[model samples]
Target: MALSLKLRQGLVSFFLLLLLLPSSFVAIEQAFYTQLLTNAEQKLEVHLYAILSELSMREDKIELTNNALAPDFYRPDSGISAYINDEQRLLWQSDSSLNQQFELPNVELIPGQHLFHLVSQQQNFWVLSIALLFDAGEQTFPLTIHIVQAEQMLLLPHQSFKRTLLQWFIGIGIGLLALSLLAYYWTTAPLTRLDQEIRKLEQGKQEQLNLSYPSELKVIKEDLNLLLANQNRQKQRYRNHLSDLAHALKTPIAVLNTSALSQQPELKEQLDRITAMIEHQLKRASSSGQDIWKKELPVRPLLDKLTGALHKIYRDKACPISIDCPEHIQFRGDETDLMEILGNLLDNACKACQHQVKLTVTDKPFCLIVEDDGPGIAEHKRQQLFNRGTRLDTYKEGHGVGLSIVAELVSSYSATITISDSPLGGARFTLQFPLEQ
Candidate 1:
């Protein structure tokens, strides 16, 4: 199954934590081990000086004041031991070294220096040694002190510390991951609701979008609601138009049925008219102008191709049709709807013009105005320009049908259409559309 956004984000956050935290903990453990080793060396160095203080110089040989030493040095199997050696004899060894054969790696050191090394016998061991020069009036003496302890004596406590730290880190990592998942789901709860509502819409369980959403999703909700409203409006318009078209065709069919001899041409004319009406209504019904998710279509090229076709149709008039549109400007609607609207408007303007037809497109307010230099319509007649299938210019065939379709297209896109007198001394039609974002 596909993962939802919330689950995907949570998994990513958890994996990142898992990857980074272990390396961080391992670094911290290494630092702690270094500090622990330093402390262990200091403890062993103290025992070396204790052995030095108890030594006595004699002409015959070097001697310790007594056999008694630190407790661990005497305790059997304590893992701690000391040794004292003269130039030519095995002078002494700690009681703790009773069953071992380990020795210091270095025999001598500089007068003021002590040295530490690791050696192996029964186990890995730490051996610390020092050389001190004693002077009498007539002779000199050299003695070496050695302290040896098993490495495990120092490492055992560090191992326990590591186990404790690992436990704590694992616990913290799991806790943090849980908290992250909780927050992720909480923050995305509204999105889940929105998704459910959309599915409900697709299944026709709901008439419209009605869920209350957070601000982050509020704009999207509003847009979806607008889309649903537009779809319903288009359906209603199609139903009303179909009913009216049927009523209209009934009269023409009745006229043809009643007429008989020497009325064949009249009957043929009525049939052609009925056919035209049916074709027009079918074309309008099929155009899906309620597409709210449509992308912007570039307007310049559509206008360009349209004006070219009109020029050919009205070639005898040779009307100078000028276009003032930006090459990169776009219209936010279905491309076919725009073509229908613009095509009808421009063709009407071309029909009415005597000498000039001009199209001006503006970006700031996102509108296009088409004006022609012909006899303009009076102001009173302009008010009824968009009524369904009502021809104010009865002299021109199909005038009402084109303008009604343009009005419907405009309504579907939340646009406005207005008629006014033009500066060119003719009628002007302006289509103002919503701004592109």
Candidate 2:
């Protein structure tokens, strides 16, 4: 079974969110907490100043005449608490702190300068303190206001806010996930359609793929269409070859029925022409082209196997086959196609070699250049070398199908094959594949 591209993409998206979303949630939570604390502090400052305003000057002695500035100041066990100090002496404390015992934070007196801190007493609390200086009848006195808020003041509001914030985070997280999934579906919709079309093709549910796809998938669609076209061409070629063979054999078969084709001089010549034509068509019919789904062919191992086999056959001649091929270099095609191609080339080169034949494979062009130190092919003959059964040397024991099949393969891969003279005074077949992306 083929791997699902959708499943692979889904996993990739999930991992990306897992790596990023939590950190975003954490940052939001911290910012929310900080903002909540800031708002609470601002409200406390208002109360701190109001208390100082309640102080009344009496007999040149400052007195806090209004203890009822806020109901919490009078209420017992209220989350809000306050105290007043005249210079270094204590003047008053809120009724809320009557039952609780804790040290109050010191006050500051840079005019409007105020201070706040958190401390643990009978319970944890936030303490805000401020100092005010009053002058009456040439007399100056120092007054400080301390506001004590029990932990409930902070905790209660925070818990309420926390619940709301958490709800939002969870809701947003779900919404974000949903959006991500939606975006993925939309983005890969064309691919999903293409996949279905391909499946339909494989199952024979459809005659040909005609699904509308995105621009990015156009190449894939084109390639598939090309495969179908090639298959159709093969069937067409088979029919045409059969028809031609039937027409061609009609005269020969009619003559052979009347006279022995081998014994009769004219019939024997006709038989040779018929046989050569059949062989030519058969060679073309055999090429099936590159496989629709091809596997990579490793350079070194394949070359080693081919060369090792070739060396044994030509062992008496002592023709050395040298290969300069990288282990990791690979041919992206059918293993059989590769074997057929290299086998024919190597066999011919080994047969033609005097002493040394060299095979060099490289990835830059994904090519194999085979060279032999034998009598080189002439320029005029090189053009016809890839023509079926057109051997330059008829005595060389070959039907000359090797280079022609190679020509067909090169055409399929959109590759180039050039035969030239080698420095070793022999033929150099440069079969270059397109560079792998």
Give me the candidate number with maximum lDDT.
1
List runs of model 1 lying over 4 Å from the truth: 1-4, 59-62, 84-91, 101-103, 106-109, 116-122, 141-144, 230-437
Prediction 2 TM-score vs. true = 0.51
lDDT of each: 0.78, 0.75
> Which 10 consecutive positions of candidate 2 have the poorest summed lDDT?
286-295
Per-structure clash totals for the candidates: 0, 0
Give the local distance difference test score of model 2.
Answer: 0.75
- Roughly what TM-score does model 1 have, to 2 decimal places? 0.54
Residue 193 of model 2, lDDT score: 83
- What lDDT does candidate 2 reach at residue 71? 84
Go through the candidates in order and give the C-alpha RMSD of each one to the true structure. Answer: 14.4, 9.5
Error of 2 at 309 (Å): 32
Backbone clash pairs for candidate 2 read none
Error of 1 at 351 (Å): 47
Across residues 1-437, which tens digit of lDDT does each residue of candidate 1 receive? 11377678777888889888798789878988888777767888888777777867676565678864679987888889888775666667888889776754655577667777778766798878777776655876676777888888878887998999899998988888888778777887888888787766654568676989899889988988888888778867887787787788778676766768326877666565666677567657756556544555678989989999999999998997899998887676566787888888888888888899999988766798999999988999886877766776645466366787888778777788999999999999998877742
